[model samples]
Target: MACYRVVLIPVDENWTPASPDDVPPQPPQPNERLLETEDFFSAVREAIQFNQQTWSERKGRWAVVCEVGCPGKTWPGLRICTPLRYKIASIWWPPGWEPNSPLDMPLCICRTHGTLQEDQLSYEQALATIQALNQQAMDRASTMWYVMLAVENEPVSRTISYDPAGLQTTVEIRRLHVAQPAGGGHGDCSHCPARSLDCSMVAPA
Candidate 1:
């Protein structure tokens, strides 16, 4: 099962990055309104809504964590700055899910960066391509290629560093098991190309 947590980052008006290339403030001001949930996607959905409504006018951003044992339960998590497309493809698909179509994907919004418009266009174009690909006849081997293409096309985060002394409250971090799609045409990955590759043979990244 995937575990998630939402932390509200307090805004700093006087604090600005020393350089344009500098990274965001580590761990972000003190995290408030810590919320935990077992459902990863649902947590993200709530974060988006929270940002749209409350965080829009506020100075800081709300971050969602996959909770993989990072210090203070930060870093290795989804911050407000992370692109929504990357969040969906990277976080959602590994749990043995297959979208019926592009429409199944969730809409992502980032009020802090004012990226809602750009992300909307990118989201539409990406889904449109995926839809077109779905119409084509694909050999089993090519199925994984479809997934890889979609993932590689999206933007990646510059870094994954959060404050080492992150969360103050007690938090449990655990490994995320990538579930396998059941066989006999019952599971989401029944048609996935991941089946062709042997997990044991693949080296860990």
Candidate 2:
């Protein structure tokens, strides 16, 4: 299994503008950089695969809940960081319908500050923790949640929404790590053991 860390971002649904036309344009998060198109796509694909693997391994035989392959490619939630508007807008997607504000755009970011991560947290641990956080936060229409994934040894960062459907603990780490040569979808990543994703920016523990 690849080792990685993640930063969690909370979406604020209450942001409002004067009118629909005045709605903030979607773009990359402020101070943060955009992962290349291929990198971003690889992250998304790997994330979906990771989530599916952990959930199936822990829970045993679950159905897919995300529209990952949807023709429209919908986001898991509506709330987003404000600075991430244009980054998302750069892609072909439909405006997510959010509650209470006509000017509310479907983007899933607010600000790029105060990112939290626990490098020790594994795929199952992160998923379980985020689910709990969402449940405690409750069903709020104004906010969308995200988990930025950093492969244990990979340098690139990618974002995923928090899934509220479950809050399961008790993960059994079926994957046993052994030293392997460096290689992944993005080619050789000398930083850490090769997994599905490459490592260009991950800090070793």
Candidate 3:
């Protein structure tokens, strides 16, 4: 089986006013990046197929697990899942009535059914969970989360139909390194950028 490293970018919820007249800011959307180790495509395809089969008959709540590390020390990451329940109400129909019309039936059903189970935690909570998992992985193996980008290949001419040259695939990944916070403080910048006025600068006058 191939190996792949997935990195998910947490959505930023904290918003500040861009201008006095502007409306309150909204949270940014979460971005997901997947990195493959030489055989990412095959591994990801297998993972998805396995998950789909597991989800079909699995009862109660569901969680997605990602295996990390080699045989000596392997860790399984968890993500809580919740089933989607849709409720469609109409004024003309009775309460809790099902849509008989084919047009309305499609709309009544939620589209995001087979997707991964979603967590109730906020953006910050999700980020914290990911960070903790990454730290655990780092402690076990020297590997860190890396974002996968598009692949590049050499050009091939159509005139030479069976030519075996000029065909190459290059996978790009943005590596993220884990390091100790500056000053060993709480990672938050509460006292950063110290003002000179607060410093002991005696006036010449």
Candidate 4:
């Protein structure tokens, strides 16, 4: 099974990162309506389930552990940021789980020591890179080049036919291309002398 760490925990504004010497947080009070608490399993679960909206809203900010060959998450890359599935009863995990351990809860289950930021920074970088490449192709050859973003020589992001900013969404996995004419099966790749394919994804600075 993959290891998980708690990334988003609903806490008070004044809450500070817990230290080893500090006492563990107490159960939610009768009036703290943020996360509606059931019989507590772990401190993290209490934060996740106590409120209906607190965790639901945070689902948008989910993160993933960066794979070795995989482009680090955050950029406007193709890999979809999916919400992890979890059952409340499963929160009562076996021994060895600590406060900072990867949470197995239903928001994000990180496999790495931690997770990349959920802000889709990688996608933004990828978009910017492709826009530059598109401009280069237009200027160099006066033709539109399909810019493909790659990581470890593999194209993990979408194959863009034109400008990246015109895209409706970034997590596109399939090759977004134009419909080929009869008897011409993606002939542009073989026929277009000005065509080029390149990766725009780069590690965060």
Q: Which candidate is the best by TM-score?
A: 1
The Cα error of candidate 3 at residue 59, in Å, is 6.5
lDDT of 1 at 183: 17
Off by over 4 Å in 4: 1-121, 142-146, 150-205
State the lDDT of candidate 3 residue by residue for 78-190, as single tens digits. Answer: 11111111121111211232322112211112122221213233223333443454345435642222111111111111122333686755543222111111112112223
Candidate 2 local lDDT, residue 191? 33
On lDDT, the stronger of 1 and 3 is 1
lDDT values, one for every candidate: 0.35, 0.26, 0.25, 0.26
**Local error of candidate 2 at residue 140 (angstroms):** 7.9
C-alpha positional error of residue 73 in candidate 4 after TM-score superposition, expressed in Å? 16
Worst 10 residues of 2 by lDDT: 82-91
Q: Backbone clashes in each candidate structure, one number apiece?
A: 1, 23, 1, 19
Using lDDT as the measure, name the better of candidate 2 and candidate 4: 2
For model 2, residues 70-159, the per-residue Cα lDDT tens digits are 121122221221111110111111223222222122232223333345344444454454444433333553244333332312112234
Q: What is the C-alpha RMSD of each candidate to the true structure, in Å?
A: 13.7, 22.7, 27.5, 22.5
Task: Report the C-alpha displacement of residue 33, candidate 2, in angstroms.
Answer: 27
Compute the lDDT for candidate 4: 0.26
- Runs in model 3 deviating more than 4 A are 1-38, 54-205
What does candidate 1's lDDT look like per residue over 1-205, in tens digits? 5355656665454545332112244546435655677655445455555655543455555443333333332344342322233111222233343544423321111112111122322334544544444334122312221211111111222334446688344333222111111111112444545555543211010
27-125 in candidate 4: lDDT tens per residue?
Answer: 121211222122112222333332224334644222221112234233222221112111111111212211211111111111222212223223235
